[model samples]
Target: MNDPAIAVDGLTKQFRGGTRALDGLSLRVSRGGIYALLGPNGAGKTTLIRILATLLRPDGGTALVAGHDVVAEAGRVRQLIGLAGQFAAVDDHLTGRENITMIGRLYGLTRRAATSRAAEILTRIGLDTAADRQVKTYSGGMRRRIDLAASLIGRPQVLFLDEPTTGVDPASRHDLWSLVRDLAADGTTVLLTTQYLDEADQLADRIAVIDHGRLLTEGTATELKDRTGAAVVELDLPPHQLDAAMTALQPLAPRRDRDRILLPAPDGPLTLRHAMGLLDQADLTPTDIALHGPTLDDVFLALTRHNTSRSARSTA
Candidate 1:
């Protein structure tokens, strides 16, 4: 489709206690790939998700899903989107198949169709053998997968995943990532909200970094990383010399990570030489030093330094 799958314009939502969950936030998500809303806790990531999913109303502005207005055409939007929240919404007492089938039926599918869809999705999500098993018997990873399966029962065009891999182990998180990639490859547009830096870096085709209910930046992972600089200089100095070195390199805006001090080398080699000069001025001898490409962690550190987070009354 030529139009974006999801669109928001000057969205504003305030709570009863005068807290701003969303402050004139606007975003455009294209169809058929993963678009991530990246931020720390209470950054309004969940608030945006809830508004786009039509679970909550936006106090101002407008939104559209698959080209339909979220407020005026909520019913139409609901028909085209599927949502999987932070926690698994499956019944412990029910079998995985039953849970999925029930959701399909609620979407207005006939018993036979719902059953068939459940079976198809169960296998698609690698839960076929566990289909008949009670959800209570499933592992944390398996339960998350089952909840995802239920969301897919209707084969929605646009899927909303709110922190999909919040607590899954590394192995399960990897599996979920692969599944999400495959779904996008098959033409499902996924709008993911997450606080996990690696999750957004590894999965999103593009990322929107939001803080305090507003956009800080938006781009491909590499593009966002480049915002920090072309490269980063990491220095390992003698433990005793750290204090003097910090004061000496104040102009570089250095931040310490464990035993290393990180500085953005925007001019690459030139900035690197400057860092060494600054250290030399303080008579500080470094144990080691190197320059490397910017990472999401580096980008995040740069952003948070200038844009601090504030507490929201309630959004999630």
Candidate 2:
């Protein structure tokens, strides 16, 4: 990653109905990296993407995409960026090649140039064999890839993906991930927004967690996980023993996820040992117990919980 490809500062947007979508949110994204934005529904992830893609204007503040002001030089910014929304945007009646070629023509390419470019991109995106088939016949993953291919017609310097994999199957999701990595490796700056924690953990070189249209935190996966806790002591037991085990470990302030009890191990091995000792003293025969590093899910939960609690207190 090098240089700020996207710069957003003091950005704010409010709807006519008095809904504040963005609250002075600001973040900078570097060139040639897979940057991910993680947040819940209505967190303003889409709003931010729309602003950067020149689809919507921010009510206040400044945003620069590809070194061009999003509001002032909208046309220039549009030329340097590509965007895919939450769902696939394609004509079901057209073939994959036709779709890409059409987008190319819209980008000012000649008919021949558009056709040649579309043929080349179809191969690159693994749709060459199915290029002639109507888009309605393609699978969900193929539709997504085609939509992404459409975005690449102009060779955009900045690509915005807002929930690109939503409602996609596991296999399709993996395919999309590989394409994103390849794009970044080829010097394309990608800005991805997804609710899938693993998507952010595996693909993003850096991640920004936003809430209420404001940035809560931004860093690498490891950095964000470190803010939660050092390790997790997970205990697995039978249904009957769950209550006893949790009650016995009450002093540790354990939390339950499904059938397992999760205890924050800030002291790492020391906490693990303490937990084991407590279980032993209580004569609880557990099915299994393990220690592992905190996961992205843990980090997300911890951050959101903290923010919600703070917001509640502020209101109180």
Q: What is the C-alpha RMSD of each candidate to the true structure, in Å?
A: 3.2, 2.2
Q: Cα lDDT for residue 125, model 1?
A: 90
lDDT of 1 by residue, 1-316 (tens): 7999988999999978877879899889999999998887878888898888888999999999999998898999988888896745689999999999998898899999999999999998999999999999999899889989988877889999998998899999999999999999999999998878999999999999888788889999999987766588899998888888889999988888888898888888888899899988888889999999999988876686567733333333
Task: Give candidate 2 misplaced runs (Cα > 4 Å).
Answer: 1-3, 277-283, 313-316
* Cand. 2 Cα-lDDT: 0.89
Best by lDDT: 2
Query: How many clashing pairs in candidate 1?
Result: 0
lDDT of each: 0.88, 0.89
170-209 in candidate 2: lDDT tens per residue?
A: 9889888988899999999999999999999999999999
